[model samples]
Target: MQQIYLDNASTTFPKPQAVADAVYQYITHAGTNISRGTCATTTEDLVFATREQLCRFFGGEDSKNVVFTKNITESLNIIIKGLLHSGDHVLVTAMEHNAVMRPLQQIGTELTTDNAPTDAITFSRIPCDADGALRLDALPQLVRPNTKAIIMTHASNVCGTLQPLAAIGSFCQKHNLKFIVDSAQSAGVVPINMQEMHIDALAFTGHKGLLAPQGIGGFVLLESMIDEITPLIVGGTGSLSHTEHPPRFMPDKFEAGTLNLPGIAGLHASLSWLQQQGIDKIRTHELTLTQQFLDGLQQSEAQNLLRIVGKRNCRERIGVVSISTDITDIAELAFILADRYAIATRVGLHCAPNAHKTLETYPTGTLRFSFGWHNTAEEVNIALQALKEVLAHGL
Candidate 1:
């Protein structure tokens, strides 16, 4: 059977040919590390070029402001831990992943220090509407005097609901609150202008919309945030060699040890490819596939057996679509889809239990089908047929 992969929200698969080639070339030919050695010209050149490419891709002014990490979870951890101190309250949306929630939970319990605020840290969740869209109007009422920032996801990984970043960013700017966005689901698939959107920080993963391999993700922050935010890890940065402490620089201050050269190389190639293809074009293609899938679902005989999560409109979302069924065993359905039809999907809370709670899908989660640049309308029809058959078979 032909395999149909629809888990782009988890991680994109079948990355661009150039991405795989770049990784292969880097591993086979260049075996040196960046920032640690002076003689590795190829590695150094690639590193610099990758940074420049990322800066341009994300609309960041300074290349130094882009710091690499293991993944978006690590990036979010670094930001949440480093930026929030005692007495600093943060406002996050109900759609935040475990990446954001867990770190904030751990930090809120800690005591204050001299350099930090005297009071303990606090977090408030801005609620979402019935359609999983963020309620921006509720933001003003939730803001506290101690609120230091508003951290949120640009798009829901579970439901594909696009948050109003510009509106939220404007609100943050008006209130003097820092705006940190988790672009794990939106980056490379959506247009993000840091300066125009008033975004202070953005966390993104490489394996998703960026089309790079896993284990590479990072964030782009305004240069001004460097001094205020603390570093998550401290070690050799290959800069200020004489000093015991990590160098107080843009990326070196945050990045430590050997970087992911292979992943970066892959990312560099994917960025180049994405740049050539254009993000808007990629988005349009994915949205087209999404609509095809939605239309198939609506046209299917199993329509009564399934419930599509979020809004019916594709313009308000990316390519992600979550579905619930009258059948209680959603995982079993996913298994059948996989084992019988070779349709791979993600079924569960999707690492955002809070988001499930907001959607009232807690305890029992929804089945998610996320589209990508490579998915075609025919594949979506096949998936719909599979779902119809599964429903006909019954649990």
Candidate 2:
């Protein structure tokens, strides 16, 4: 049986050919540890070139500001833990994933008491609407004198609702608060111009929207903010070998030990492909597919049994859709669809309990079908038919 995978939000499947080729090529030929070897001149060039490519992809302000981490979670931890101190207030959104929430929770715990290790970091959550969009109007009210930064997820992983980043960026600029964006779900899939958006930092993952392999995502800091934040992991950063102290530079300041050259090489290739294809085209294709899926969901009788989460209009959302049904257990229904129809989807809280709570799908989560550039209309139709069948059988 053919499988229809709709779990791109979790991680993209069938990554671009360039990504696969780059990974294989790097492993086969340029298999050398970056910044460590003296004779591997070509490998060193490849590493630097990959970094430059990432910088270009992110709008090319400074290649040195981009630091490769294992993934967005690590990138976020670096910024959140490195930049935030006790008594420093952070503004975040209700739509953030656990990657952002867990760190902030730890920070909040630390700020409350001296014994709490992280007592210095305080935070306020900007509530999102039922559609999972952030309330931009509330931002001004939440900005306090102690507000050091505002961290926001560019798009909701659970619902794919896009945030008003430009407006938020302007607010942060006017307030002199640092603006950090978690682009795990939005980068590569959407257009993100840091300069235009006035973003101070952006954390992104390579595997999902970038169509690169996992274990190769990172954060890019603004040139001005690099010196202000300390490195999360301190060690050999390929520079300042004379001293034990970490290098007081951008990427070196944040990046410690050997970099993920293989993954970066793959990411470089994937980004190159995206550049060639153009992100706008990819976004349009995915949006079209999402529209097709929404239309199918609306026309089907299954719509009555299933409540689609997030914005009802496709214009306000990305390529992800979450649906919950009162007729059946969402997890069980998801399993049935996968087992019986060979349709793979993510079911449960999707690592964002707050988002689920906001949508009132907590405790029992929703069925999420996340689209990708490769997802076809026929596969979406199959998913709709499978959903109808599952409801017919179980509900």
Best candidate according to TM-score = 1
Model 2 lDDT tens row, 31-65: 88867777667777887787788777776489888
Model 2 off-target regions past 4 Å?
A: 109-119, 301-303
lDDT of each: 0.88, 0.85
- TM-score for each prediction? 0.96, 0.95
User: In model 2, which range of ten residues has the least summed lDDT?
Assistant: 110-119
Specify the highest-lDDT model's number.
1
Pick out the ten consecutive residues of candidate 1 with the lowest summed lDDT: 109-118
**Residue 383, model 1, lDDT:** 92
Clashes of each: 0, 6
Off by over 4 Å in 1: 109-118, 300-303
Candidate 1 residues 1-395, lDDT tens each?
A: 88999998999988999999999999999978876776688998998898888887878879989999989999999999998877788888888888888898887842223334448887778989877899877888888788999999999998999998989889989999999999999999999988889999989899999999999999998887888789989998887998897888778888888889899999999999999999999999999999888877776424477888787769779999998887548999999999999999999999999888888888798999999999988899889888987886774
Clashing pairs in 2: 86-120, 87-120, 110-118, 110-119, 111-118, 111-119
